[model samples]
Target: MVAFHASALDGVARNPALPTPLLLRLLAFDGGGDGPPRYAPQRAGLPESAVAVILAHPNPGARVDFAMSKLAEPAQRARLVDDPSPKVRAALAYGPEWGDPRASVALPDDVCARLLDDPDPSVRTALLDSPHLAPSFVASLATHHDPAARQVAARAWEKLAPDERLALLTDPDPEVRRVAALGQCRRDAHLTAELLRDPQFAAEALRRGLLHRADAERHVAERTHLAALAENPSLPADLVERLAVDPDEGVRLAVSLRPELDETRRMAIDFTVGDLDRGDGVHWVREGLADPEVLRRAATSAHPLLRRSAARSPHLPPDLLHLLARVEDPVVENRLGIHHPDTPEEVLMRVYARLGGTFSAWMAETHPRFPREGLAARYADHPDGNYRRLAVRDPAATPTLIERLSHDPTVWTRQAAVGDPRLPLHRLREALHVPELASSAGANPALPEDEMAAVLNRAGVPA
Candidate 1:
C-alpha cells in the first residue's frame, strides 16, 4: 500500500539521486506510524550530512537500516560500533539478509572487528555468520565459549594448523568431532586408511577425499558406490574408465556429464540422455573455465551439445563465434546472442524473433544491437500483438502511437507502453488507475518532479 510508509511517495524515497537536504529530512521524518522507513539507506550518493542525520535520528528504525547499509566509510565504522541499540548493532554485526536493501553492500572489516567483542550474545552470534571476519579470528573461534561457534569453525578446519586440527578431533562435543573427522581424514592418509575400515566412515570418505585405485575399485560392485565414484570430480581418469561401463545406466550418465570428458567420449558411454539441456549446466558455472582447446574443439564438434557448450563461454574469440554462427543451432544462438560481447546485430534480432519468452530472447530484445531505426513504423501493426509492443523501444515512436498502444489488448504491451517516456502525460496519468499499470506509471521517468511531490503530498507526506 502507498500508505504503508510515510515517505514511500511512489518511489522517491528509493531514489539515489535525491538532493541531500531532502534526503536528510526523509531519514528523520516519522509520519505518526510505526512502519519501518521506506527510504533505503543503502542507496548510493548519500552525502555525509545524510549519514549524520541517520545516526542521530530519534527513531531506531532508520538507524538500523543504516547499520546494515554498505555505505559506511572505513573511518565512520567506529561510530556505528557504538550505536545505542543492540538491535542496530546486531544488524551491523550480521550481514544483511537476502532481501534487505543493504545485502549487496560490503560492511567494512573494522566494524566487524569491533563487533567481534560485542557484549551482547546476539551481536556476537550474528558476527559468526559474516564472511568478512579476519582469517585469524575464524581460527580462534575454535575456542569460543559457545559450542555453536566452535562447530562453525570446524567447517573451516583446513585453516587450522596441524596440531589445532588434532585438538579438534578429540574435542568433547561429538558433533564437532564428527565434522572435524572429515577434514582430518582428507588431510592425513594414515587416518583415512583407518577410517576406511569402518563401513560408515568409508562412505563419507568416498564422498570427501580422493581415493587410491585399489580402494576405489573395492566399492564399485554396489550401484550406490558406483554412482558416488562417477559423481566425484576427484576420480582419476582410470577410475572414470572403470565406472564408464558399469552395468548401472545412472552411473554411466553421471560419468558422461563429468567435467573431464568431451562430447565424443560422452556419446560412446553406455547411458541414454533424456532431455539435452544447456551444455554449461555442470562445470562451466565455476570461475575456472573449460580449456581453450576444449572450447574450440567443442565449437567445431558435430555434437549439438559441444557447440552449445562452446556458446556458453563468454570469452569465446571471434574465430569460434564465426564457426558456431554457421552451425545455426537455436540453443547455441540463445547463449551467444544475448551473452557474448561480439554477437552480430543480425544474430541479436534473429534470436529475439525466434526465441520469444526465453531468457535469451528477452535479453536480446532489449540489447543495444537490435536495430532501433524506424522499428515503431515497421512493427506498429504487426499481426502478433507481442511484435507491435516492440515499437515502444524505438526512439522514433511518436506520442500518438504510444497513446494507442497504452490501450493495447495485450496487457504487457499496455504496461510497457505506459512505462515508455514517449507515452503522453495524459495517457500515463490514466494508467495510474489501471492496477496492472499503476506501478509502471508511478515509476515512469516522464512523471515530472513536482507531480511526484504532489502524489506524495496526497499520500500524507509533509512538503
Candidate 2:
C-alpha cells in the first residue's frame, strides 16, 4: 500500500511489502489517482524506518511523524517539525519519548505553549515528561483546572521550588491536594511539620473542602500531618504533651504508640487512657499495662471496659477474668467472649456473630431459638468468599445446603462447594466435569465468553 508516483519511480510497480493500506491512503491525497505529485517522498527516497514508522503515524508528512516518534536525531527532528501538516505537529506534540534532548528543548516556544493545552492526552503526557520544559512554565501548567492536564502537571511539579510547592499544596482542587499530599508533600518534613504546627492548617485544608469524604480520611490526613512531626523524637515536649491529650482518638492512639512516651507522658497516657472517647480507651489501658502496676491499677477500675480490657490482657492474672465473667453485663460479657473465643467456648458460642467475634464454632452449634438455616444461607450466599468458605466447613452443614449452593446463580457460591464438606467427592467430580457448570465456575468475573470453557477447565469439566 506504499504510495509511489508513476513519474517518481523509474518504473511503476506496486510493492507487495508496502506499508499498511491506511498509510497508502494517507499518501493518496498527494499522488495516487488524480492528485498532484508534488508532495511525493520519492524525491528523498523513504528510509526503511520511515515506512515502518509511518504505518502507524497518523496521516501527515512522514518526516515530521518520524521526528515525533523520535526516530531521528534532534537536529533532523527539529528540521522536519516545521512541515505544514497539523497531523505531523500533533503527532510530534504527543508522540512517544524520542530521548532527543533538542526534541524537547528545541521545540518552538509557541508550539510548546500550544502543547500544554493539546486536546489529546498523550500529547500532554509527552509534554509533562519533557526535561527541556522550564520549571516555571511547567508549574503554570500544573495548576491547570483541567484534571488530565493537572495530573500531568503534578508529575512535572516534583521539581518545583518551595514557594511553588506551597502554591500546589493550597491548590483549590482536591485532586491536586490528594496527589500533592500523597506524592510530594508526604516527603517534606518542613511542609508536613508546618501543616501540623499551624493552628488553622487543618481547618484551611478542610475548608478548601478537598477530599473530606469520610471522617476516617480526615483522621488519616490529620494523623499523617502529626506523624510528620512525631517522627522527630526530639519534638518539643510541650507539643508532645498537648498531642497526648488531644481529643481525637487517632491523636491519642498516636501518642500511645509513640516510642517517646516517658513517665510524664505515661501519666498523660494514663489520663488519656481513662478518657473513653479517645478510641477504645480500654485497648490503650490494656496495651499500656505492659507495666504490671498499671495492669493492677486498671484491673480494679469501676469501668467495665477497662476491667474487661484488663482481663483480656495476657499480662493480667487469669483469676481476674474468672471474676469478671460473673458480672453479667452482656456488653462486657460479649467483649470477654470475643477476646477469648478459644478460652471460653461455651460463652463465646452464646453471643451473636454481629456482636463481633469468631463465628465458626457458633455456626457449628445449633441454637434452639434462631436455628441455623438463615445463618447457613448467609454463609453459603455471602458475597465475601472467606465467610462462605468457612460456612461450608461447619459440621452442622448439610448436603441439601451444599447442593443449593453448588447450583446457585453466583459463581462464588457454586465454587464454594468445590471445597465444601457436605458435597460428596463424586458430586464435586461431576460438578467439575460438566462443561456448562464448570465453564461458568471458572469464567472470569468480567468476560463470560469462553466463560463456560474456563469454568470447565477449572472444575475439570470437558470443553
Winning candidate number (lDDT): 1
> Model 2 off-target regions past 4 Å?
1-64, 67-87, 96-110, 119-140, 143-145, 183-463
Q: Each prediction's TM-score against the native?
A: 0.68, 0.28
Estimate the TM-score for candidate 1: 0.68
Tens digits of per-residue lDDT for model 2, 431-463? 544444433222212222332233223322222
Number of residue pairs clashing in candidate 1, backbone atoms closer than 3 angstroms, sequence gap of 3 or more or interchain = 0
Candidate 1: C-alpha RMSD to true structure equals 5.9
Best by TM-score: 1
